[model samples]
Target: MRPATVFLLSALIIGSLEAKPNIKNFFSKHFFKDVYGTIDANIKVGDAGKPLILTDLIQQDQIDEAQAAAEVKLDAFLGVKSYAGYLTVDEIYDSNLFFWFFPSQSNFEKDPVILWLQGGPGSPSEYGLFNENGPFFIKDNKLVLRNSSWTTSNSVLYIDQPAGTGFSFTNGGYAENQTKVGEDLYKAIYQFFQLFPNLQPNEFFIAGESYAGKYIPAAAYTILKKNPSDEIKINLKGLAIGNGLTDPKYQVMYADYLIQHGFIDPKSRDALKDFEKQVVESMNNEDWDQASNQIDVELNTINGLTGLSSLYNYLENYSDESDDGIGNLLSREDVRRAIHVGNTDYGDSAVYSYLSSDIPKSVAPLVAELLEHYRILIFNGQLDIMVAYPMTVDYLQNLDFVSAEEYKNAERRKWRYGSDVAGYIKSAGNLTEVLVRNAGHMVPADQPEWALDLINKFTKNNL
Candidate 1:
């Protein structure tokens, strides 16, 4: 984490009628200077310990104008009587750092913090927060609750990071490589810890899906390395990647395997196989465009079959717009809704969203950013052809870890969960790969119970 200079100043009293509070707010008169700059000070209060109070030096006009605009927007976005508060971090370059906090049933002190990362190199974590992975799932224009949210088991923190994605940026001058991303993320985590200083040190684990195969590992490595040697070491437990794209070479090879194994049509198989060879040869010749073109053809073939099912009945309510009768057949509403292209509001939209979102605009070119610092778990749904199990398996196959033998057994073995079948390989202390049965690209979305169980077991033993 980047270090910030701290200054202790005298606390300014607000009013005579109110009690002396540990924290107080003040606005500056400067307009063109930094959006928020703080001079930290030790302030005395009743029983709150000598707390650190950060004074925000912002122009009054700026605060009034921003507050006015926010009030109007909040009236519509929140739809009810609303409360607003602000905190100014001296080190964050952005002037506006806004967030919405909804009341949750779990106690903040008791629950573990679950920081969710959504893969995109450009997409926001909000997609996972409100829909697939977070606490609530919306249905029929109303919020229909979910029983087993990862947040229910842990306190969830959905961050829109790297400066320009979702609600976390200004002017869009974000990091373009994994090193910068890892560094920036460390800053965010450190600041978060300072703000919520009471949180347990070792209860956090980094997690994400899709391109996060890259983002999560990079950030986790940064956190682990930066942790203080004393105290509890911040745990830095383990990482979880769902339907991720960690390595380009393995991804292509896996697509070829899926095709050859009859998971996809013959045309797709042949096209992917031929393209795989071309991509490999192009890489050898350093012809990136040729390799990319071949890969594009393979991907397009897979993308074209978005809603057509290889496992279930094709004519059985194939429309993605509404899940009238599809819920009974599928495990998740997002999966059922994603069965058709028009239901692009949730998971269906993530495919195109990532390809176009801002994170990708900043992070994709920095692929080799954090390879040495983290232990990564790349998981995929066996039924998902987009970022198929073969793709994940292929990526892991090429990783040059010296402890590879320790992470996996000498021979392959089969593991069963209920009615599902998966191949298991463990590398002692480093990695483990187990395919979930009947699961698609979004493993949690397809089989939440199995996903959670796998995660719990993996973290308890590996981290």
Candidate 2:
């Protein structure tokens, strides 16, 4: 997050066009510079027209919710039994978080409910909802139901977090660290269960990509901290992270990953050694902001030296990299009215700025703590260069957990999706990691069928 001024975890940078328009891109680092409109000189967010409670939004009248609601703006009252509202986290500052909920598309009512989060320390979870595995995708300027959306069998909830990103609003208040971020989400999610008592029994999950790697594990850890019978029981089941930035200490090994993939000369490894040394020093000193800055520079330096256009994925140039349409759709008066937000902006830079120092701090220990009781799924795209598969394995292998040796010596089994060898699965105890074949940073967007297969199996304890 020290890249607060340098880079963003939203999407990898893109230059010009490529041969095929297939890859997805996010806001440029410079994009948020101008996007910072007003920083709340004086405001009362509680009275700012944001919905306080939304138990009534999900009614017997609404149909084809969530994926259906966002697509058809007409009568866009609700999504497949969907609900959209804000949860006030800090009453003193009046900071609030926005969420969009979707019901299970399956006939069964006891299906699990998964909460999808997006990274950037500031990125909205809508990226996963609209682009990767949402119930609907925007095709040819139209909203169409996605064939393999995770929502088909399970309820999905997409949230705009940290009180400044997307539709979330704040008045001089924001999270300063991963623990605060997790606490804010925990309060909101706990309130969520209170509003929808019907979903209390359905197993729940926390899933996301990129910077969310930090947000998710921290949230799961918070779930454990708050689960001491203080409130409604969150039948918590598991977690899933794709190409996450969990342990920067282990993941900062760009030189090793590059050499293994033939992206850099082995001789250049000597020059890159300084970057690693500096990052380690920053981590040792506990100056997380400095470490984050050093890591950003290191990646940018390598990307420049190698002329790699898109660091997230090496398979394509800037192809289908855009969420502009989703932005436009959300801005429409009808869409805002449908979702219950009255002209709230998306991509607030303040959220990223607030979380600047939290980027480099490792959530790996949080993962280790949760490993004792939960089923953890950490999968990454094979072609992802940002958080490479090797980097993920590196940390998981060395993670301080009960099944360290067992997981280290565990065999990697072949996994399939209808005869197509989709990926490789490695598991020991409750921890499961997979290397999705032919996928880049966005695994669900590139190989959705397999992504669905992975989650369905993981939640069902079938993996």
lDDT of 2 at 224: 93
Return the TM-score for candidate 2, rounded to 2 decimals.
0.85
User: What local distance difference test score does each model get?
Assistant: 0.46, 0.74
Cα RMSD (angstroms) for every candidate in the order listed: 19.6, 8.5
> Which RMSD does model 2 reach against the true structure?
8.5
Instruction: Output the lDDT of residue 183, model 2.
Output: 86
Clash counts for the predictions, in order: 12, 10
For model 2, residues 168-228, the per-residue Cα lDDT tens digits are 8888888898888888899888877766667888899999888888989988999998898
Can you give the TM-score per candidate against the true fold? 0.62, 0.85
Off by over 4 Å in 2: 1-80, 319-322
lDDT of 1 by residue, 262-338 (tens): 55555445545554665576566655544544444344334343324331111222222233222222223332222
